[model samples]
Target chain A: MVLRVLRSMIGLLLFVQVSVASAVLDIEIIGAGEHQIPIAIVPFGGDDLLAKTINAVVMGDLQRSGLFRPVDLAGKAPHELSEVSYPDWQARGADALVIGSVALQANGRIEARFRLLDVVKQAELSGQAVSANGDQVRAVGHRVADLIYEKLTGDKGVFGTRIAYVNRQGKKFSLIVADSDGYNEQTVLAQNEPIMSPAWSPDGSHLAYVSFETGHAVVYVQSLYTNQRTVLADFHGSNSAPAWSPDGKQMAVVLTRDGSSQIYLVRPDGSGLRRITFSGVIDTEPNFSPDGQSLLFTSDRGGTAQIYSVPAGGGTEQRVTFGEGNNFSPRYSPDGKGFVYTHFINGKFYIAVQDIQNGQVEILTAGGWEKKPSFAPNGKLILFASEARGRGILATVSSDGRVQQHMFTQSGDAREPVWGPHL
Target chain B: MKKLVICVLLVNLLAACASEKPKEVAAAAPETPAAKETVAAEPAAVAVDPLNDPANILAKRSVYFPFDVSAVQDADKPIVLAHGKYLNEHPSRKIRVEGNCDERGSNEYNLALGQRRAESVKKMLVLGGAKASQIETVSYGEEKPKATGHDEASWSQNRRSDIKY
Candidate 1:
């Protein structure tokens, strides 16, 4: 028993230190956003190296969004409002301009002060000082970008968010958490067995995912801070697809203990086990509504796999998808106005969204090996799994089906990509 | 020195008894000298388990299914039934049925379909006289595939269940 405890302690230590210094994913953006904002970000004045790093991060974030076109500065660098030259920017067709400065504080913290100016009006739109530890230079840059993006686009920026995905190379599978830009990749769990369906808790403090290390599919909730994990469900047969409620108190999981894949609700502590669906068929991938009053899932009880909605307390299930192909992996938009899912037709899967009120479906991708569509917290982009060059890669498309991005990992086939909530 | 001589005589007697009934000696020889003696016996007189014998039908362990279908087809029913009979006769043995799927549907959906395929085999095994406790079922979804190709030929090979002892 003492040896077992020591072995587990060693295992815990290995898990906590499992962060891999992997190459940042190569991203390809396609289809420019409608009405792209022409913005020029001037290099900050203080701390040349620090300013360059911050500017690079901020510029990369805006470019990847495909919603902004960078204006050429032509060697124009302004540190303050007094040094600003509005006529030149206007002549260069820049709608807005951004200027920032970074300084290393005596307390070992880095401070970045930035401002967004409406060039046509020659007035300041927004300005603020963002500060963080020296090690969190990227965080400060993301914050500055968020403020700029919100001020210009009138939408909350997601550059500060993170995403979770599973990287499978041969038989070795790892659950990874990385920044939304696919940098700072951290391996939450790495094992020889397969890991699937990682769902972030509502608070983003924990991740509930399915791991097969126990000889079967079992759901585990692991703390992102302590690297501690507890088995949320290990019932006989498969226990997978753990989706937390919006309130974070309860989670929905698919279990085969009583025969057939069915959805069940249980508290975060594994108590209050209750079966919600009685289809006696394949009913998996349960995602909660934003209000926590209902769940959207994929079921095949109607002779074909399609999306459906059922109340949180287990009542009549209403079909949500109809027409040509089958749909799977339905995730409600953040506003609960519509849902995004994978539409499988003609042996290909495409990410599609449907308006709940009008029931109008819009195909967001050209269609190929795409699956597991999920919405970003802001509902501006939908992340999904896609295949490129015969390897699984993470892909995202804007809600309007215009802007798309394909992010390819360096080593393994990245699958099951889920965008986390806004930080 | 006298005890060593007696021990040698006892070993010789045990070896003689093991050669006469290798099966009984092999069955009873757990951490005993007779187990090694039984291993030395002639192969012709020893009994081999059908599961390990390549020529036996029980050695054929896999059951295939059509896309999105869980029912065991007639072609693979015999293999599952053979394992069921083997498990019934050998009550001490237990087997696990691992289900797999092609790379077409969502991973979670494929996991459920794979599980249904495994459970379908388990149901047939129980019907063929194997006890429910003797069988365990698991689904690997599309995580494990026998063929990596994207065509139908490879997908058909991947949509299968393996009965492992």
Candidate 2:
């Protein structure tokens, strides 16, 4: 009950968070030192209210990065990136300057133009114009951030990717997908019954989800590009969990055709069936390790649910998580150093990251009812579902806990977001 | 509450209104051979309501689970069984079990774990004599949840198979 009240409060806060315009803008500042970049984002070139909002969101984003500090909005720096006047910002201890313009375009599109200027280096680091639909303005901000991130880190950004989730609507549920920045959502599947798991193929071109539409739990892989789908498994006794093989040719799932649920490898075409788990009871959730040499799953052989690792070819198993909680749903990072899974410990469920090489684990959330954290292909961000304001919402936090943002809207309750592998 | 009430009323009225309209069309058009067939099939098409008929709903369905866990303690069981029986008798109706978890373990492990929970319920229902082929199961592991609250109650609610009938 207290949680419900807290969610209402946070729901109001989140409404304000997404609705309120930001005062500080994120400006790129390339400098010589590893020290934080001091930035001055002057009033944007177009639309006073929108510029302010953009500036504030960018400012908050950078602040959360812990690598930049915003200069005062009142600082008198009458310089724009169009003409080089680095001395004015440099004199104000500003390491960089950001300037932008927003224009409402035809066909309900928006054009956001941005330039990152370095005060000390006296150079323009990057420039780009992004076009987005009216419903995608917030997503445009994330794309702008992606550009800034690429300018700084030289790595691609996942800001354009989307997360798929499931939300219970009374006795039924809806499978929803939304942008990483939480905008332009569409319901892919809505069943008055229930929809459970949703997994993105490694290529990000298809989705594998579990649905009870057939009066039983079954795995179906749908090609997002074509809308054509094939049933991967529908075993008689129990058929669930469709793990897309990294190669996309096959999937490792669990089937209870023998009257007991066991891990099985089945061809994507529904041709082959091979059982790997010999356990007499409860061995499930088989995820492919990055190397494809091991499978991470859960088994009750230990008398309770715990994370276990076994050879990909099917062999003896070893327990990996012995912490206070019983663990399930282990997803190995693409890089394969460790794994991320749900931890049920002390009667609380949270997304935790564990290093397989060493027995190290850490919680990756600030607070408030978080579950089902999946990593972006870059492995730098974790996306999970949470309840805020009496509705399920998706939360994105930097994997290192450096930046956190909560996304929920009145359109519908969003839950169980799985980050697509690199797009 | 209002929505549910409206849905039930609308479905009932539509079904009832549909029954008379088809018969009138069939009787008047029976002179045409196509009309005769249409008239002949009116009675067959208006058999029973999906929700109101128990024998129809209990005809061809069951639930599944993993190996040893047979208690049906997972919260989704009660909800799924209702759907299972609904489809069992419907005969033409079909659905799938979407199993999930609370996001605590490995993806592969959770997949199986979710499957076990789903299959466990399925097996119990089969022994109780629900049709085997009428039910299919899918493991979503921790990839999906019915409730998003991070607390134990919410997680427990999420860690089971969802009935889609």
Candidate 3:
């Protein structure tokens, strides 16, 4: 099954590269749950280009979520709610049906309407209409998917969100932002130096990262809109590992100017520098808790690298992880109930999540060189960097580890993925 | 003819004795070759800077460390000491110690670890009579790896502190 899926993924990747002007990430579902929601998405009735593109985008979003298995409609689509045949969808093993239509208005605007139906009950669940310009048809489709996903799952959808990651090809490194489904990739910053530790601000307007452009590690915060950036930390020694506070007013960074690697809190403009952790050993990778009262970091004060927590203002450090192998890059879940990190054991690295209240560790991935796990805004999925086919690839796993998907780029290695907040 | 031969032999003997005396003088003043060469007739050898001399221990710039370790090992002490001595002798010369780590753990933690490694070497250089101001330390973490392979052999080669003058 895995081989067959991989072969299809490769074939689709080649087709996408040759046929499409705007390239997209190729997703390969690694594992699936025993039961998947079967849904049928009827092609939106329109001969225009925008309609077909929106239809494909909606289906792709649902299929990538791993929660719904889209059944092939075999060119049979309903243009409106009255045309949808509930019995036909049910016969094709579709528990739910989606019917939509897109039309170009006389004012040069695109209006899209979709309806969700229960095949068994033969009842309409919900319906909504969204209008946008021709350029925003993709985003309109994502919004439609979001509505459908929430109606069925009782949770907010992440299809409309974005993710930021680093892509390295030869001597060039670029920071790219793409849709949650790995489409519409845009390189925000491209340089000849190495970029690491990309952290999105609370408002998702800026990204603070470490760059080695000046022959040393310096932290910089770049604005996604203005295309302007400011040097956050450029101390004498090494300034790296920039993590934003939950409120977006302050940032936690690792600096070695004073002495060993210690955590320091600095404003976004690089002022009001105050040391937070006073550990004699290495203290780095500071991440603010969801409540913004404590900081989770990795330290080797106990002779081995482990996750630890200290008061955001400064206090005694407490070790939080006691599992075998080393744990690093701890990121709090959206709700702050748990945190995810990269765990190394038996010569293999895995992504794991630990409950904050009970300290119970649950390994989410089997075994791969996985690192830098960042939770989605809803906290239902975790995006991380893993090695596949001897190259780095971005992957996502359901928080419970039931479903897995790999997002591979055609060129270069993709790593250090940080899921953006809901816009 | 015999008198001429005897006179020539005496002159040759005197030249040999003169050469033997300079050899004894060169041995007596072993540490001051420049001064001894000035007094001799042969052209003086060019002075080679010890720092640039491959035969000198100061030429060894990289001080390797064990995996995830920052402490300076005993085997690498000689190289550090040679650099320390050179820095002390030439107080005007400034050196920067770059700390690096293998690609294993988190980049931030490795940055901290690399800083520790660089600082440890800087501390040792200071303790060995080099001025604190003459040396600067920077940790490149795993960003500037000397080896790209993901193995013990490559990793060991990458975990090091290089002294740049």
- TM-scores of the candidates are 0.89, 0.67, 0.86
Instruction: Please write out the lDDT profile of model 2 over residues A94-204, one tens digit for every residue.
Output: 877777787777777667788888778888887777665564455556666666666765656666566677766555676666555555455666676556668887766
Which stretches of model 1 miss by more than 4 angstroms?
A: A1-20, B1-46
Interface RMSD of 3: 1.1
Clashing pairs in 3: none
lDDT values, one for every candidate: 0.84, 0.62, 0.79
Per-residue lDDT of candidate 3, residues A43-155 (tens digit): 77764687778878888777666688888797787878778777888889998898878888888767788789999899999887866555556777877887888898888
Instruction: Go through the candidates in order and give each one's DockQ.
Output: 0.59, 0.22, 0.54
Flag clash pairs in model 1: none
Q: After superposition, how far is residue A2 of candidate 1 from its true place, in Å?
A: 49
Worst 10 residues of 1 chain A by lDDT: A4-13
Candidate 2, chain A: TM-score? 0.80
Q: Alpha-carbon error at B35 in model 1, in Å?
A: 40
lDDT, candidate 1, A1-423, per-residue tens: 235323322322332435656556688888888879999999898999899988988987887777899999999999899999999999999999998789999998888988899999999998888777676677677778877888888898888778899999998999998777777778999999999999999878789999999899999999887888899999999999999999899999999999999999999889999999999999999999999999999999988899999998899999989998888999999999999999999999999999999999899999999988899898888888899988999988888988888888887899999999864
Give the winner by lDDT: 2 or 3.
Answer: 3
- Model 3 lDDT, residue A323, Cα: 58
Is candidate 1 or 3 superior in lDDT? 1
